[model samples]
Target: MIKLTERQDKILQIVKQNGPITGQEIAVKLSLTRAALRPDLAILTMSGKLDARPRVGYFFNENYEVKRQAEKFLHQQVIDYKAHPIVVDKSTAVYDAIVQLFLEDVGTLYAVDSRGHLAGVVSRKDLLRATLGNKNLHELPVSVIMTRMPNIFTIRPDATLLEAAKKMIDNHIDSLPVVKEVEEQRNTYFLLGRITKTTITRAYLEIMER
Candidate 1:
């Protein structure tokens, strides 16, 4: 946790926006001597807040800051950060799924079976693809095109936000279905909620400021 002074923040901002600008130009803009700025530059670079190249001067390393903060926030769990999921039954029609998707404004929907186990997953794209050349939207079952269990990718509520984010990225999926195992029933998983890239990003921004 490195905290920047007002002067350092200003310098970093200048370098970040007008980076590769000469040290002399930065000093002039900030009304400081090259000598005074050198120490601040050294501290910034040493703290991994800035990257200085010989001919390129100074540039803010966005990836460095993101990585550092991600490490700090990696312990956050999906259960604490996940949003309420939009769910539909496996027998739901494509027409109804479209209505639900629009009503909820969600990109993905979880399909559960009668036993309260995850049955499949359907995306807005799946419904759209199913409806493309057909006039039988009402007759089509979501299960017909949904990604079935054992094939559906899921994340536990206890999983770290970073882990959930990585899973979403790796699977090329927009959202992750968060599940909780029930002790009463064997092989039964309940849909706890959902975690999306948007959810993680918003949470990261909100908490990182603290």
Candidate 2:
């Protein structure tokens, strides 16, 4: 939905409070001529924010608010709010990985090989399962439990926040690794950042408040 101008908002308020009001009456309230208010009325009506009748005037469209919110989410780009990735080497010990997870206070960590390409993803649950009844956390490599490339879900930097949120819901995961495709490699990607449910929630709050 298109954003309303201050005048348009005032007009909406007037029509809402005094529903089925005529164009002439609305113009008078705004201290403007009917001709001057014509364009705004047409836009609001065309955009489904207002409905008009031959003899009756204008009334608020009940569905406009929902449409406006959906449009807002659809336009929000992920790169604007994506956070830095917390990473660990694939060969890092499970014990050291657990320490890093708590130290960083994050739910997930991206594991990379020696060349720094995204190799796998390790979640808190993965680490927990790995450490149960195991005393050799120091010797056990994180690679043992990490979700490898073919199974790891990821998003691109330019994807919309709505897309990011949908991926999390569809995959039943808490976070996604943001990556850029390598020019020379066929299917390899370079990890750029991370987007999570928390990031989307914060973005929604910021947008709504603004």
Candidate 3:
């Protein structure tokens, strides 16, 4: 993340609030030279915090705008961008899980119980650590090394993208499980999708341009 100076932050605020505006106007109001302002603008755009359009000027990326609007816009809902989650039964062998991870090229895998409810998460690191000295990969069950339920981070379908981003940052986790509430079953949950840090960054850029 690019660190912004006080002046830079003020400049961004001005542009976000009243942009598609000219640099001269911004300079005059902020009491800065056009040459001085140039570097700030370049940095903002480079950091994915601002976008400059030719004739349209610059505008605040909608993703960074936290205020709620009624318009049908992007928001964090797992089904919207989650890829088909690769899952393995708790009974799956460690060797098989490693094979799946390589084939899928994902950092983590979801472990589901017999009922299809989320049981645990097995990251690639976990599998590697578990297989370090063991020769019985085929006999070991994934359940032995998985991050169990109640410890897993999850998000609902209606949450905003900002909320999801904050959660991921706070946990220092790369991905999240998107689970849906069953209509008739109160205690059970079904994994609908998954979200990643890359997903959030891409969506943030897309919304900001609007």
Candidate 4:
């Protein structure tokens, strides 16, 4: 959804109150020139907040309430929903990674390099697959099987939860590693936290409860 500016919001309210009203009329109410309100009117129309007919004037979109509520949900940022990340060293044994998964009851774990920068991602399924035909789990480093950098999908702390959810759904993953870039030259990032499908569900539930 398009985020509305303060002036745009005011324009929406004006149209709601006196819809099918002309732009010139709206400008009069706000003590502004018709030219000043023209841009706002155009924005509102394009955002689907207002509908316009050449001579009939602007009418507040019939679906305004639903769209506004949707905007609320989609704009909820990932930073607000981030949870502590379960991290393990890239050199950690496959057996140890398996233990961490069950002990924490998390679906995925982040693998960090020696500097504590994100290196890879290991999932419960990956650990299970490693155990199927392997006998030396302890001797096998998770790095051998973990999804490596440049291949891993990650979310930034400031990204929207909607983006996080979409990425998870598109990739068939349940969670994302929330990272903050510390070294742009090397493109290395420190794991700040994580976001999961459960987190998105919980947030929606909380919104509904309110």
- Tell me the TM-score of model 4: 0.67
- Of models 1 and 2, which has the larger lDDT? 2
Give one digit per residue, the lDDT tens place, for model 2 in 1-210: 488899999999988899899999998898999999999999899988899998999998877887787777788887887999999999999999999999999999999989899999999999888878566999989898899986888998899998999999998999999998888885578899999999988987977886
lDDT of 4: 0.89
Q: Model 2: runs farther than 4 Å from truth? A: 1-10, 28-32, 73-83, 129-136, 158-172, 196-210
Q: What would the per-residue lDDT of candidate 1 be over residues 59-100, giving only the tens digit for each residue?
A: 888898678766768778888988998888899888999999
Per-residue accuracy of model 3 over 92-167 as CA lDDT, tens digit each: 9999999999999998899999988988999988898999966699989999999988788888766766677789
What TM-score against the true fold does each predicted structure earn? Answer: 0.63, 0.71, 0.62, 0.67
- Go through the candidates in order and give each one's C-alpha lDDT: 0.86, 0.90, 0.81, 0.89
Model 3, position 62: C-alpha lDDT score: 61
Model 4: residues with Cα > 4 Å off, grouped in runs: 1-70
- Model 1 residue 173 distance off true place after TM-score fit, in angstroms: 1.2
Judging by lDDT against the true structure, name the best candidate: 2
Kindly list the per-residue Cα lDDT of model 4 for residues 1-210, writing each as its tens digit: 578898888888888889999988988988999998777888888878899999889998888778778778878899899999999999999998898899999999999999888999998888888999656999999999899997888999889998998999999989999988886545688889999999989987977886
List of clashing residue pairs for candidate 1: none
TM for candidate 3 is 0.62
Off by over 4 Å in 3: 1-76, 182-187, 208-210
The reply for model 1, stretches above 4 Å from the true place, is 1-72, 183-188
